[model samples]
Target: MEDIRDRILRPGVNCGQLARAHRAAVLIDGESYFAAFRQAAMKARRQMFILGWDIHSKVELLRGDAAVKAETDGAPITLGPLLNHLAQNNPELEIYILIWNYSMLLSLERDPNLRFNLGWTLHPRVHFHLDDEHPIGASQHQKIVVIDGQIGFCGGLDLSHYRWDSSDHEPDDPRRTTPAGDHYGPYHDIMMIVDGEPAAALAELCTERWQRATRKSIDVHGQNQWDAWPETVQPWFKEVDVAVVRTEPSYKSRQEVREVETLYRDSIRSAQRSIFIENQFFTSTVVCEALEERLREEHGPEVVIILPKEVDGWVGNKFMEFRRVNILKRVLKADVHGRLRLRHPWVGEQPKHGVMIHAKLMVVDDIFLRIGSSNLSNRSMGMDTECDLAIEASSPEQEAGVRRLRNELLAMHLGFPTDEVDNLTKETGSVVRVVDLLSDPERPDSKPRGLGPLEAQEEQFPELVSEAEIVDPKRPLEIDRLLDIFIPDETTQHSWLRAKWLWVVLGVLALVGLAGAWHFTALSDYANREVLAETMAGMARGWTIYPLIVLAYLIGGLVMFPVTVLIGATAILLEPLPAMLTAFAGTQVSAIVLYFAGMKLGRERIQSMAGSRLNRISKHLAKHGMLSVTLIRILPVAPYTIVNIVAGASHIRFVHYVFGTLLGMTPGILAVTIFTDRLLAFLRQPDLSNVLIMIAALVFLVVLTRWLKRRFT
Candidate 1:
């Protein structure tokens, strides 16, 4: 039978294209990649294109250089300033940098004023752009650096804060501090450097992405006369072919591409001796199933995987963690011959904080080596845009290079010399056996690169980790198809009412919430309507009371108190007519106060609080006249006061704001006042007609809310 590698691997199917590299080297860890990139950038004569998921302006690319930092006028040798210096020094060189336009959720986590500073610096040769042209939930995740179109670097390392770390991966390394001087855990990632034709190929990829994002054409000239390859960085493979694979979501009418996933699946299936993978995430069901299938065969090659011990984000912790655990369990179940091993890299005496493993890398025996920004996650497979570079060993020399790189990576993580790892592997004829022999099970707490198997406690949550399978599906699914999972099985009379069950269920929940509020809150016990009305009317005559009410609303907004509760209180305290007018005036005042307060806090703070959803919603409201504001006010998609602040921060017009708030609040104020004012009467008389009327009003409110949501959203 033909080898699976020969049969499954093909251009445009499992990869984008094949290109030759006169010289290629693997830069292990961010420290090495950053240094190499810095040297190359400094030597650029024409153009330098830098692109990443994130690019921090002040991220220290060259750390531990007290003399060099002082020599540079103490201006901090960060990525932004360094690039500016390089561009300014080389007047003919054009530097274009592209970073993903991250959501507001990460606004505070990154530099708050990076965009403004980058633009205000006013360097004609330096250009910076934010790529926000991807699909809703997707990100541009390629990390590439092309210098003078002659030398290029591509892999998982991003020129950002806390990404720089030595190969030792000391958990408590003092050099692992951020630009803000806050200490962080040691990080690990890899990058590949290629010179010659392959570098120009990567440069072409960067140009296409740049044009797509900024609509600006970046001229790709012929072979560069200048050589930008760093003299210090030695080549690992000479005269080899590198395959460039990509994963692009279907957006802007472009066809979807899953070349990265195809390459990964094919590579796993083709492993003859061993399959090794190290990734930050392992939540792709398809990849897991592929591995599980291979493990089912009794004579299958041994598989070893290294992952971070804990998930980093909300979705990662709850959703991805679940999927990871579930998939590992399935793989273990299929591993009847015990050929699979999954562990995380540890560096403590007692297994304290594990080093963060961010490298997306795979090695299949000695035939294939891959390293890039494509994680073994669902997003990398088909949602997020990704790029990976791979090399298939076609000759003895190339195969030796691949094998040596894999062994070097293992030695770094295992705290063993490269030769020792090789000797152990040769002695045992198994990669897993070598790892087991080096790992100290009896003294698992020992430091440096002790391996810690995933804890036995993960078996308890079989079903929880599987929830991430929804968002991390391995293939591209259309919006309609993805949404259909939420639809009910039973047919409905009206095609437009296909989601009627959702509305019905929401209505029931709302009613239950109302009942709970009435029962568990002060509303039921404090039924002194006459006393409250008299007291409120007596105070209403004084001008001081109005300011106090407005002040109270302002303070309420600051504390994030629910506006509905305040409105309900207004209905209970005053008569219907006065309460209606008071509600209108009070809400407008509150909105005005909060809007300006939000303005004072600035858009960054407001956005951080509102998150990306509120920012997106505020943009919609700003684009419309009164309808968007009115819809938002009525539907309660977000907290009322926060929306007001978001509107203020987002620069919605005051006229539109006041009118929309008035129109949107009309129904709610009237309904609540009618219910509150008539509550005591209904209770005393037990009038069925009044009760039926209140029920009808509630139903109408629900129906209107649903209609507005469908129309606007």
Candidate 2:
């Protein structure tokens, strides 16, 4: 039987039509991509628009010579300065940057001393807006640069701090800077500069994004934003076709396209000689499956990936990295000739202080180039919106240009020169041969040296583990192979057993909460009638009741009681605190009860009953863990009651479930509770001023809740 990779990579299979109608070229690296982008912005004749999930104005594009010094005191280059300079330099240039509206307060308080604060920048040529029109759970994640309707850049690199560094990837280079107060890590990224019909198509995409984000019309002009316009210029590539892929929330009749995944599939199917990739993640099973088939083919192209040893965040590691490592191990099993390699660049230490790779680039046989904001993971493919620019080389010259681009990227990785790369290629005839020659086991001292401030640091921080050994495609999946996907591993089972009693305790507490709410309502009504009447009279005078009602609901929600039941109980009792306490207690109990059901039913078996929707939910929960669960619980966005039940029946531990629920629900509960209490007080007192105060308090709580949710969840 043929191996998986062989079956996947066998030649002569035309999966689909290849669109070739435009030409494109652009040098991409952390610094160069930005420099080229800045140059493109300067040359924009008509309009420039940028959209991203997160945009920081403090990011500096062009570091000053002083940056090389360790002093850290020279004028900090920032995105604002660059845009300001561009707008000032060209009066006709119209630039708009739309960043996701994280929170109203955060945006206003970002930088008070900055000249062009995002909240208050008023340059006529430059405009900034917050994007908040998407559905509650969606984000605008497209990153694009359009200039003069002639050239455009679209890819994964964002205009943010910690994304700047030369391809040299120096270890201790003071020239490298990170906003997080650490030396920059090794990163790989890709972007395409498109001209001709493709450029026009990209320009149209920018216009659409601008309109969607800002609700305004943007006109494209022929005049360039550059200081002097060239009457005519030659095309970078003979002919190229670019497809504009996008994703947004389901709005009206429009459907979001899973462009990132589609592109990945197409690239995998079209590979001829080799498939080279650089990404922050390697987790998607579907993509891995395709690669696995290719690896089984005798003449299949070699697969190479450059990634960080680990992901950056805790949740990312737990959910994404672990899964990714397991999948890669399986893929390696199909590599009979050891044609697949996964490498993480290290400047120092076995683990600590090693620079993480975060670039995303894919090159296929010098015929196709893909650079974009998508990672090889589930989120970038379909969950979070993404955009990419793909250019195909149809002719020999175009293919050569593509090869040059690939060599430039390789040179950056190996710390060599363009001409040197060309010479090496001439001698070796392929990247694989050149890499092998440079990386000869016996000649470690003869490898091309990285230049600049990091040279000394590099020596101090030599590779502890062999790169080839770590990434050898011949390695078999070991421990992971013994573990079943649905079955609980030893750690998971231990965790569940350890936390089992907690669920029982919570269930009992919920009953107490329910009983308490009922008892309080009865007692308050029976004995506090006069006080209740007085409070009601005061409320009639001027106070609002909505705030008090909201408060009751929040307290009930936190305790795991039905919101309606808690509200009714509180109103009947005329005692806010008891009603709130009862509600809170009840909700906790409900969660406990649900958890026990999950433990008994088995998470996997229960999940199967719910079908794909629940399966997706399970994946999301597994990926994001307690944080995501808590977010959904507190917000009550996606059937919180059902989730509570399903989560209990799932693999999530009781402790995580409890902690996440308690923490995530706090904000919403507090806001509603405070609102309810204020409204109740106002209704009892009948003071117009009190009513106004209640309104103000309600608004404050809402805003506060929203802020807290964004910060933590």
**Which residue pairs come into collision in candidate 1?**
322-465, 323-465, 349-445
| Cα misplacement distance, residue 444 of candidate 1 (Å) | 13
TM-score of each: 0.70, 0.58
Q: Residue 643, candidate 1: how far off, in angstroms?
A: 7.4
Q: Candidate 1: TM-score? A: 0.70
lDDT of 1 at 359: 94
Local lDDT at 30 for model 2: 65
User: Which candidate has the top score in TM-score?
Assistant: 1
Maximum-lDDT candidate: 1
Residue-wise lDDT of candidate 2 within 41-127, one digit each (tens)?
A: 555555666766566675666665623541343332456666776777777778877765432212232332222344235568888
- Residue 261 of model 1 has an lDDT of 90
User: How does residue 189 of candidate 2 score in lDDT?
Assistant: 60
CA lDDT of 96 in candidate 2?
76
Residue-level lDDT tens digits of model 1 in 1-713: 23687654588789888888999999998778877887787778888888898777767776666326445553335677777787777778888888886543334345545566542373778888777656544568899999877898999998988688988888777878877799988688999998877788889999998877765677975446667788779988999988888998875446789999989889988988799899999878778888988898878889999888886654465456767776677878888998888888877555566878899999999879999999999889888889999999889999888889878877887788889888888788998987787787554543356667864236433444323433465544332222222222223224442211111111111222333344446864433445544655576665666565555566666755556666667776666787777777778888888778766774666456434434443444466747656766776444566567656776467788879888988878777777766664567676897787667767876787677656654
- Quote the positional error of residue 343 for candidate 2 in Å: 1.2
Runs off by more than 4 Å, candidate 2: 1-23, 66-77, 88-91, 102-120, 133-137, 178-183, 224-239, 245-252, 348-355, 416-437, 448-585, 588-713
